[model samples]
Target: MAQFDVEAFVDRQKIGRPQLAVLLVCLLVCFIDGFDIFMVGKIAPAIAEGFGEPVEAMTLLFLCQQIGLAVGAFVVAPLADRFGRRSMLIFACATFGAVTLASVYAQTLFQLSIMRGIAGVFMSAGLPMALAMISEATPRHRRSTFIAIALAGYSTGSAASGAVAAWLIDIYGWQSGFWIGGIVPILCIPLLLFFVPESLKYRTERNPKDPGIARTIQRMDRSVVLAGDEVFVLGEADGTARKAKLLDVFLEGRTWMTSILWAACFLSMANIALLAAWLPSFFQEMAGIPIQRFAIIALIAYGGGVVGTLTIGYLMDRIRATTLIPFYYIGISVALFAMGQVSFEAPIFIGILLFWSFAQTGGQGGLNTLITQVYPPRMRSTALGWSGGAGRIGGVISPIFGGVAIAQNFSLQLTLTCIAVVPLIVAVLVFMLGRNSYARQAVIASVVTQRGTA
Candidate 1:
């Protein structure tokens, strides 16, 4: 009987100073993501007054930004796979920052909307690229953990953005939010240039799969078979190399499963983006809370998400990733439904918020990890980003719908309850997908065994 060595498990990823620096750079980039996305919500009221426009008009702006994100994700992410991860990320960050800063000088509603939309397009590229880079940089076994940790920065950024916006909106006005958003990424440029190395796994040669994929497959063989029943999983690169392409996900072995997982990505991320975009405004408007207080409540939501994310990681390490995801979705749907019904009663509201946060935010993290694991390295980031990008469409739509419901004098309770249905449907979809994923993995394992015996 042998014991598990966690350190050795993690160390195989070769996550030294340079990789860690990449993580830090990713954190800064996500920080900008959190700040800018939420900044729109935080300053929505101010923007309305500044332009003397209705909240509904502002909601359209939110939708436009998300639309830009979806386009970027679907169109831009695949290019990262085609080119390289580091260049895409650096360019994405710098583009978003410079564009966002330019947004500060806009004088009209149209200008602000266009600038914000452009910023959204660029910022959208950052998350997927970062996820791809981190996955490649870390060892295979420890990839999810590193990914979860890296993603935590997004939540941290979300939390900090609220606090920062709460303070800055008073002193510098809504434009200041974009100013900070732009400036943060500008500062990240030096680090990205100096510290962030190109992903060791990304290819420079014409035959990208030649040595890299072969070497990874060799490592895999050593760890899984040669190492005996030790479950010696390679976190970074195994000795074996399997050539990976976007189409390979479907054509080779697990196409059905990949599609299912992509659907899960859509559901899980849609819920998170929807909430991140709308929850604050909903609380302030329907609950009749002040901006500062609403920010505090937003913190609570993010806090619950943090708990959920950590909890998902714990469950994933012990149990199958696919098996655990559906349960989280069920919990999220229930919590969101309860949120629709709950009043200002502190205990009840808090419970709703926590559940909603955990189920959606945490659930998203879990889904992301599962996606990263199921796909081969080549298409992993693109899949996650594209799926997430598609989910952003839902994010954009949810807030706009919420705003419409409120404007129409639709009962807040009814609107919120309706929103809960999206998660419920998503939970069912993901559960079905999870079952498919498990089935697919079993099939793959059986096929491998058959091949080995032959």
Candidate 2:
């Protein structure tokens, strides 16, 4: 009987039409996911005006949406392990789009919150599943870059939400942003169904006898021929085919690594959430910056995020992630500290904002890439989902923490200095994770080498 190592074959292959197709489709999924996730913040005021409610009334809506995101990451996303990433992703996209579309008709903030919360449940599944799909498909050498490219779509979509709101909200009403965010994903469902292939590694690990494996390999590279009866394998010593469980993330000497990753994600996300929720207000109220000027600065800073995202991905491909990833976080710490000390009127403050966004947003993207690298296929989705879920808890907590600081009338320098401490902690945790991952890889390489010699 013929045998093939599907994992090795994929690692050896160069990027081709088939792989590019996967990347594009996953990018679309992330774009829409980001659009929907960030749209609520952009249109909150318009929605409040329409509902005859104060803007503060939307706090429940934000809470509900965040809680839903946490639940989806913890619960809904892991189902991809049992079902399939492609199938679960398509289901998530379709349902999230439909619900978000329905939200335009909501008569009250309560009703809208319910719809958005529901949408969040499905929306949360898109990015991680997209990451898993792209990570499994791309060659190892370029995996981080490909994932980052796909991730940029999410950031782009987020920026596009503001642009859509500025353009369409005033003219067509707040619903216009939802209209675009909703219709686009539903439209892309056909593209995902037809163009995106299921993870070949997943198929081999789960059911090697499946005939689609042969066809997928042929499509990826037409030169390879596979007979029907051949046994396909992933060929990793630890990659035993079995039912994936949530506990598996903690098993296999992953307890410390997983703990460190979760802590890093939590701290980093908390800092991000605090800034996202309070930065505009902080600049306006404390620094005496005009709201309009801060908006412009914010827009310019987002551009830095895009540059950072792509830059980190490219660098990660060439550099050791342990060194590069933590360096980004440390840069975030320095940027945040400098922001506390610098004059807002200074031209250099703009540069600080740029570096802050570059490091903060890019560092978060690096964390996602690192998660994909650390985990194996069987429990990769679970690890991503759980780590993200932990981060969401931090995301939920930090905004409230910022609210308390604002209520206490805390000074800008003090509040920012407090926030600056988070990334330093994250940097330390990530550094430890990097060392652990390096040692683990060394052991695995040594074992593989010894086996080859034997």
| Highest lDDT model number | 2
Write one digit per residue (lDDT tens) for candidate 2, span 1-454: 6678887788778888878988998899889888878888988999899899999999999989998999999998898888888899889988988998998899889999998888888888888888999988987767778888988899999999988778888799989988887888787778778988889887788876677889888878889977678777776534345667879888878998989989998998888888988888887777788888988888999888988889988877766666788889999989988998899889999999999999988999999988887787777888888898999999998887777877898888988888888899999888887678543573344234323432
What RMSD value applies to candidate 2?
3.1
The count of residue-pair clashes in candidate 1 stands at 19
Per-residue alpha-carbon lDDT of model 1 for 1-454, expressed as tens digits? 2222222333354456756787788777776776677678767887877788887788668767877788888777766776677777777878899999998788877788888888888787787778877766665545556677767778777777677556887888878878788999889888878876665455422243333434433443345322322222233333243444556556655766766666666655666666665666676677776656765665667778777777776556545665677788778778766776777556778777777777777778877776665665567667777777767766655556766866877665676777777666766766676567444474344234223332
> Residue 14 of candidate 2: its Cα lDDT?
83
RMSD values, in order shown: 7.0, 3.1
lDDT per prediction? 0.67, 0.84
List the candidate 1 regions with Cα displacement exceeding 4 Å.
Answer: 1-15, 48-60, 204-249, 273-296, 340-343, 346-348, 400-417, 437-454
What would the TM-scores of all predictions be? 0.79, 0.95
